[model samples]
Target chain A: MPEVADPEPLPVPLARAGDPAAWDALFRRYQLPLYVFVFELVRDESASLDLVQETFLAAVKHLGTLRDNAKFGSWLFGIAHQKCRQRWRQRTEVLFDEIPESAGEWEPGPDDLLIRREEEAGFMNLVAQLPPPQRAALLLHYVEEFSLEEIARITEAQLGTVKSRLHYAKRALRKLLEAKNENPA
Target chain B: MKTPRELLLARHRAAEPKLDALRREVVAAELNNQATREQSFKVSLVTSLLCCSNKLWRELVWPCRRTWAALAAVWVVLALVHLAQRDGSPPALAQSAPTAGMILTFRDQQEILNELFADRSVPAEVVRPGIYAPKPRTETVALLAA
Candidate 1:
């Protein structure tokens, strides 16, 4: 399997050293993907844009604290994830049940479930309906192509919790797809 | 049929141009934020350093102000005394050492004083050790006779 690369190899070292061009390059590379992820989670364009800007600002300020420069993408995603969580907390008090961070039974991963082009809109709508944590996990795992470990780090959840979320999220998506197929409106 | 990744990408295709516009805004905003943060950090650093120096003065210097003043006064007095002693020292004499004629004159004065103070009755010949002539006192002769 080919290792998934971050859109491009960012000049993290120069950016960390406070280079303006390097910072611009880093933000340019990640802006779209970061905006997409934030927009999907928050569903507000202005808020998402603000969060993206906030995330980049934070990345510029604290880039020195990031130990591994190679994991800059996941690290940036982690920042945006925290921003979304903060926004969610401010907007509503939605409580999530405790998810057991234990090894779950075998299940079909998102990769195994083929999504047809026609079902894209319906699938995204279903995805939006998932619980915030599950949606974040699914988006990070499938859409952003982050590994389970990366998703766990980005979400600040246990590795087992990440796996459980991915498992349940894909299951819920499949059910929604089936239901939509049966009631072809 | 497409993978979920491709489908999601397709779903977001419409937003790319908007994202492109937002990119310039985000970059500009981040640059401004970074500037503000750096400025705040510099200000905080200066404030902390000033606070630290003040604390040091209060803890280490203010408590011993009297002792330090007394020590400074003693040093001042010592410096003044040293300067006064340096200035008050006697000047060197201008005259050279005494000549041989001065030494001969001193010896002649000493001889004349010894002669003037000698007994006139005891002549030089009578005062010789081998020709000793005894001049007895009357009281001594009477006692000897008795």
Candidate 2:
């Protein structure tokens, strides 16, 4: 994939001062990205829209908690991630961390080409099938192109846990691809 | 062949246009929320100031009205007493300047006394110095012996 350019810096101080134009500029910049991240995780259009709005509103209310303005993107994603977690918690009693780690068994090489254009739909299907934690880690790491530390901060996971989840998720995806390729059904 | 990141981004790109309406709605909501919060803050501040002023009046000023009136009455009485005393007293003259009549009276009394004493043939209204007046010789000798 071609590298995406860095977006214009957000007007964090103006937004903090409750300027409508500043908040609008911020929403315009992050609304789509935040929606995509949330929609991909939840797979519900309405929920994704609501989550995006909620994330913005949450940003408005607790903007003072953000210590750095340069980190606005990750911080906004972090709020969406937490909102998704809340929804998940309400729907189920299952714990996200208890999912077993298969990362130990699979050591994917640096040059491994795990995805292809033809397998795009299959790849997303398998990704959606992944557990919430692993899927979140993968999307944040690959799709959002956040650093491993940024992913950890966004997901509120440990650095090692983020690494492990990314490793395990990719390994699982590769296995799914291999299985599909072998069967050819 | 596209990478997973590229494929995912393309897939989600379909939904971007649909979010324009949502953007307008969210921005409107945020602006409205901010306006409401600012209005409430202003109201609360004004209410607090009004409450503070009312509390000051109730606690400090209204209850002490009797004491304030009594203080005013005392001041008025002191002022009246001072004015009455000032009105009754004689106006003072400068002590260094005496009137012509007072100087003339003083000089006349001194002259009369001096004249009476100087002429010993007239009975001296001023008592003559007894030691200088001639005493009888026998009385003087007897006085000396005593």
Top candidate when judged by TM-score against the true structure: 2
Classify candidate 1 by CAPRI docking class.
Answer: acceptable
lDDT of 2 by residue, B21-135 (tens): 7777777888898789889999999999999999998998789989988999999999998898778855456335888999999999999999988955656755566567777
Model 1, span A160-184: residue lDDT tens: 7887888788878889778868887
TM match of model 1 to true structure: 0.62
Candidate lDDT scores, in order, read 0.79, 0.81
- Candidate 2 per-residue lDDT, tens place, A99-133, comes to 77644532434634556666778898888898999
Per-residue lDDT of model 1, residues B70-116, tens digit only: 99999999999889866975533534677899999999999999999
Give me the displacement of residue B111 in model 2, in angstroms. 42
RMSD of each: 18.5, 17.0
